[model samples]
Target chain A: MDNVDLLISRFLGGKSSAAEREDVLKWINKCPENRKSFFLTKEIWEASSICSSEIISEETKQWQTLAWRIDGLLQKEKIIRRRILVKQFFRIASIVLIALITGWSGHSLYLRIKSKTTNVGYEMVIASKGQVKEIFLADGTHVWLNSDSQLKFPTEFTSKNREITLEGEAYFEVKKNEKSPFIVTTRTHKVKVLGTKFNICEYPEDKIIETTLSEGKVKVLAGDKIVDLLPGMQSRINTETLDVRVGQADLDVHTAWIDGRYEFRDKPLEKILSIVERWYDVKVVYPAEMKQMCFSGVIKRHKPVNHLLDVISALQPIEYSISDSEIILKKIR
Target chain B: MLDENELVRRISDSDHEAFKELFLRYYRPLALYARKFVLPESAGDLVQECFFQFWLNRKSFIVHTSLKAYLFAMLRHRCYHELKKKAALQHYENDTLQRLRYEEWRYFETEESIFYFDLIEKTKKSFDKLPPKCREVFDLSRQRGLSNKDIAENLQISQKMVEKQITKALKIFRNELSDFLPLLIFCVSQLLLVVIRKVFF
Candidate 1:
């Protein structure tokens, strides 16, 4: 109610003068608690703008179109790989006779196969679509991966670093080794640690990459820039630009998947549905009008798909029905 | 990081991680750059095409320059070709589109946008947690865009009471923050609010 509080409110409402805005900014960033509160207040004020239905649909449509294109190429890559192998099989038979006629040529053919097999040295653990799986490395480090995820690791840890590559999302309880650090390599960034607990969500399909360190210290290296994350902080790396954001980690929200529980604090109805699709392995057909309807709640990952749908319907003004692997969500009239 | 040349070389050998690593590294910036020249909607499509080409040609692909430079050159041609096909070649000279001015454009183009996007989602959640009177006052000022005096008059309360209720709402949001960030960057905290306000509001 005091003048400073009035200034803060005015600044939040876009009515504050330049000097007053500076004062509010300084006060808000003076500590974490202030930043936290400013975050909440801004959210409340920005709600209506956030609910813009057109922008949400357009953005997702962009992703869907690009994703379908990628899927087309990925499937094509699969067939092409097989075709190459078949052609090579025929060539190898003819190659053997030619190689015998020329000793050096035989040695070269052997080297080519050796190189190809060596390329396959990297082992991949794929959690098929709609699957979550856990793996423990030889070093006692534990990793739990989310659905439709892939972890590519070497058969044995190299002398320099223990490195593993992640495609979708995973949580790690790394074994401490001061001499040899554990490194997680994603498509865009690398997380390095001597030993630590953290969760990483860097789906190639998603434009953003998130890293939340639960305990100890981990260094997040993106490009030439290296960011060190302490326990309880998350680094959000943008795939398109140079901006990397460091903010308070919601440990419960980020780590909830470890217990098969998914928590959405306040997510759009459509956003939740996409997650539901990944969580329940179902295709969601929802009315476009309800895209702006936002909800917040916790849903266990293993519960029946309808159980979640039922709970959501009871809480919010939306109706849903499921058949086979498809679920349709309609606005309640 | 291994120099991008090494990454691209490894990608040529069909290393999915390396390809992805390269994709994650360059995709955002390339998308942003192409967006400057091409129609906004076509930017992402063009970049994806570039990546698809990069993947298909990996076996024979060899880059003599930095991978960053390589990607930029590849996308530059794609955007040019796209415009030519549309017969909007004059768009290439678009004074507004030529220089990206990404410092301001980043809020819309970068991954950091998610932070603000999320604040909107969490805003409702946090607002719902405020005390009843405080939430009511916040809705009036924010959703209804009423002045503090107007809100006070409509609610039949003192202006000071309205101020107090709004302050109470902010306090609730602050307490709800998940403590991932240690709040050490004094500057980001300040610039963040300014930027989020400019962006979402």
Candidate 2:
């Protein structure tokens, strides 16, 4: 119980004036003993703060929520393991049967099927709901895959070309190589590029596949149409009609997810909720009337889903109830 | 209770019970520690993220120090990332630099933070020995973050009395700490040896 000890205690309690705080800091910097003693007192203060029942109850609730999420992850992993095993068995069995009928070696037939599928030596990287994954290819191309998306790429690129297939959404920074062009194939369109940065968003449920270029050049092909896109340009291909439309790109809206955020500008509530669903890994059920309700705001992807819904409800006349895995939204009268 | 090393070994073996035990013990304290830097709402998420990451990388996660030290270090790293991200969004250069300076001060002082793990248990035991009124006053000052004057007025006590109780509580904590002084000296000497080797080698 010295004057400086009291000052350090006041500082740790966040009650010291700025001058007093500076004095405490100066004392701590005076010697290692002073620093150690300050930290020791600070720890006793913090540990005593945890002895209250309020914290224990809060701790129990938080643990349950975290435990539930961990359980879900474990379940999903088990299912993925089972699915891979079954798929591998079927793949090998079919390859053997086809080889016998065609009078070819099993190894050669396996190679033929692999080449036909274009996945012979490819590795699949998946980003589950509420998660984002980054992958680096052999050619030094970087991809930021969005949630609920998968990318298939070879372990090493062939001398002639660098190719990858995308099923959901990804942002790419392709390494520049003139001799071997980088190409990305989605279900609806194929994008060819050479040393460029771009984002491709083509979720299967969406009606359009959009590619936004941030730097350099890219050529997007859909059906028989080929369009060259410069930086600050976007190409949207209609999944059903195979028509391509090029327009000025909104870089913020397209690439915000890379920074763990989503920007919506007066978009329909339905569209926003769909993105929110993927962002939180939770299903949302709402009345039909609210479908056309438009929302315009930016939502951070790392926050709890309730925080997002609370902000939305404050702006609009709506009420949302959250369950274990679903959010039910009701229109407020 | 299982030892810290034993818990880590079991965790790497994917023993859910060991993970749960560790989470139960550390989650609250870690979350409270994070609140020193982040908003209350985001602190829990940040802590949970660390646990999830630890689980995912269990096989490859190496602990050169104790598990408690390793976890606190990880959470501190995450908090720095979070602060930088917010700073990036605001794009305020001075504000970012100011926050970084403040954090760096604590970062340098944090080596002794890991030493508090066992001290915390001993402190909790000593807490129950404090007079009921003294414990209440200290809780108001520490847990509720109330000023001495504010706590005095709220509890209808004098400001001097409030300070006296808090001072008394600190005395008990220091006495408890003295019991661990020998152990602390040994640990510090070991750390100094390692640092000396690295610098001279």
Candidate 3:
């Protein structure tokens, strides 16, 4: 390489021995044009350095902040999605479990009743440990008796219509017969059906009468007033006013007793306790103020009453006692 | 030299630690050099992107040359592309302004009426008259502080050729301004003569 090329290489490498550095300075001094070129190069280099440093630092900071914000948003979305999935899974699982249990219990109950039958004319009696006797009518109709309840019906209906009488809550599935209507007579009211499924809830201690229709149609008569119910419809008769009001019926809540699943939907705490008392064959007592609380949800009717009480106590402050065939509930404080 | 070759081999094998070591070794100086060519904010990014390109094309990299030379060459090429882009943008802006003026006024003329305007315009015109390659060599040496060897390496020419080009450019500049030099010298000599005459006449 020539002298200029060697000098250029040293400068480009940014390396120079003390003697070589002096030689480059002397060369620059020998020519005015060379001096001007060197000064211009230095100025341009300095300007570029200043400009790039400021811009690079600003861009890096902005990019980091953007990345952090994106990470935070993604994390929040993941948490929300996880919570929704967990809740949805639990809700669906509970419904499925309830259906399976109810089906199994109903099948077992049907088998037990079938085994006890002797012949066509003989009475087929089914009695629980502390509950009243029940019987199934010949035309695929069912009747349930509450504790201390007694129901009597012929094993076969030979005449124009099928009829039965009940002392307490009894659910019925009346055989479809347009020509021969089915009738269920209670202490205060009579229910007439034309091939419909319904529940009649009447107790001596409870003055109000409730009848819910699950399918087809039923006519409820109290005094002179008559109420006709379609599928998924209910009627409540107030004994004091002698008035009847019809509204939407929930089969799960109204007919759960026959399936061994007692369900409540925003019912008053007093009413929930009353149903529990009859199903578990127990007595419940609570302060007047505590009766205002509402209860909702379903529990297996065969489960120990204490288990159900524990669920309630977890949600609110309450206490309970079990004595042989009775259960009592009261506010904790 | 053996260690450098080994590091390059490891880097080609996708070893991140070796690559990181290489990056740390060259980042500061390359960034400083790039700062002389681009805006301060973009200098670090330019340096990082050059390293990224190096890794991306590692499979194709010829390991015969020192990795340092190859990296510097890549940076230099990127700087040239950046300058070309900036020049195009400037040209586009100037063209837009000129078009806008013509549309509004219907007549646009190049003004030549500023102080020392003729001399500066003449100097620019003469500078533009040089051969393209000669001008490039001169500019890189003068404006970029690149030595002849760096210019030869960057431009793919012999070091002797870069030195000859710079010498030719200096001779042309001296010739172009020779007339002004004589006048300047005569004025300085007259000033010196008067000062001496006043001191010892």
Candidate 4:
């Protein structure tokens, strides 16, 4: 038994022969106590090797930081949820009001987009639910508008510069003209480029306005902060904080909507479901647990919303039930 | 004081108290474990982030294993990611060897490793009870990875005396830890009971 102790110590101290190592392994497997002692000794040995001298001080500080973050996040989550509820209520009320004023049927209001020339000599294009629209500007720029989005532009390009207003998401391939810079204005940001291919997303419900440049250079201006984004770079502007973050852009994921697919890499389920809600025109009601659960895959836009839900349910232990235009997700034991 | 399964359920239900309980229970051990793979400065951040993410994904996080095991697994994954990021940023030194060593530890990882912080504390208490000379000899052998002969020579003691001290230390560890095991098993079984009830219910 004492010999076994020596062997175990030798093994842990990195001085054990191969034969002694095997012997120690056999003894550890011999009984639960042996295994426990083996682990206990290893834990002590590893703990002793930690070079940090200020462990206790650092631990208290870290705990405080975590506690503060948790408190802040909990408050933020509650506010965001309440805001979302209020926004949804107003959205439904406005839709009903628009339907009444235009004398349009409810079905038509739910599914049809309108592009009208206003008396101010500007064109306004709105993409309805479950629809994607492509438009060609007079300056020869091509724009692909995503579902539930709005784009406003002048009927003709002015001599100084071409400027347009957008809400929600759009992918643009601008016609190059050095003299005339193309500018897209959204609620929180303005993207300026001489001529470049890029994707901009600024959904009103979202907290961020994301712009991904695929080709050429573009300048993203959030209030006074201006950042030049080169090809394959993305900029995220926080609408509330107004902080801008720039990073390497995943072009495929950003531009996948133009190709009739939603390609995501480790994106949260809540974010994906929100997009799904826009694409399928359904209201998703999921528990809070879905917030940080992530999924990665290609979801074809042509398929029914059930196809995407089925894919999610298969990968996760979640069960879903669909009503007329509402879906409920529940955790499955 | 609730069982892990109950705590997870409550956390999924957005019970902040349950989340706090879970964090306070696991934070020290997880941070210690993460320090094995990454820098000490990053270790605390990594573990904290893991807990935050765990809380956020509580509803969808279906644990096929023990919650302790799952937490360690997530921390390990995050440590790997952090190492990869650091390697990419530094670009001068090759972190492949460090990464390989990090991967090697996965084999020896037991769910029991989560008890490291408590075990080490108890071990230190028991160690303090030992005679000073015996403690010194054992510390040299374990902490510095010194050979028994080298320890004996460093302390100007006979090699046989060094061996005897180490054996004595191990025997005390065996006894001290054996007395603690039944209690550990009882707690573990209680956790298992909660998990079984959750699964079958």
Q: Tell me, by TM-score, which candidate is best.
A: 2
DockQ, cand. 1: 0.09
In terms of lDDT, the poorest run of 10 residues in model 4 chain B is: B192-201
**Candidate 4 wrongly placed segments (more than 4 Å):** A1-120, B1-201
DockQ leader: 2
Report the lDDT tens digits of candidate 4 across residue range A226-329.
99999999999999999999999899999999988999989999889888888888899999978899989988898888898898999999999999899999
The CA-based lDDT of model 2 is what? 0.80
In model 1, the runs with Cα more than 4 Å from the true position are A1-120, B1-201
Clash-forming residue pairs, model 4: none
True contacts kept of each: 0.21, 0.35, 0.00, 0.23
Each model's chain A TM-score? 0.62, 0.64, 0.57, 0.63
Please provide, for model 3 over A1-333, each residue's C-alpha lDDT reduced to its tens digit, 9 standing for 90 to 100.
246545633553355566776666665556665554443333222322222334345444534443454346457757988999999999999999999899999998888777645332435344433454445577877566555455656677766767677666777777788888898777777889888778888776667888999999899998898989988998988777768889997887888777677788787787777777766767776678878788888867668778778988888888777776666667776
Residue range B48-87, candidate 2, lDDT tens digits: 8888888888778777977888888888888778776766
How accurate locally is residue A119 in candidate 1, as Cα lDDT from 0 to 100?
Answer: 54
Where's the lowest-lDDT run of ten residues in candidate 1 chain A? A47-56
lDDT of 1 by residue, A1-333 (tens): 256556766876777788877787677758776786555444344443332333344445655664566668778888999999999998997898677768877778889988766854777898865778999987899999888789988777756789899998899999999989999999889999998999999876567799999999999999888999999999999988846899997899999988888888777777677777777788999878887677888878767878888988898787887788898888777
Error (Å) of candidate 2 at residue A74 is 1.2
Stretches of model 3 off by over 4 angstroms after superposition: A1-134, A144-148, A324-326, B1-201
**Residue-wise C-alpha lDDT for candidate 4, range B110-194, written one tens digit per residue:** 5545555556567667777778988898778765667899998999999888988887887876677766544444333322323
Residue A80 lDDT in model 4?
Answer: 100
> For each candidate, what is the lDDT?
0.72, 0.80, 0.63, 0.79
Ranked candidates (DockQ, high to low): 2, 4, 1, 3
- For candidate 4, the TM-score is 0.40
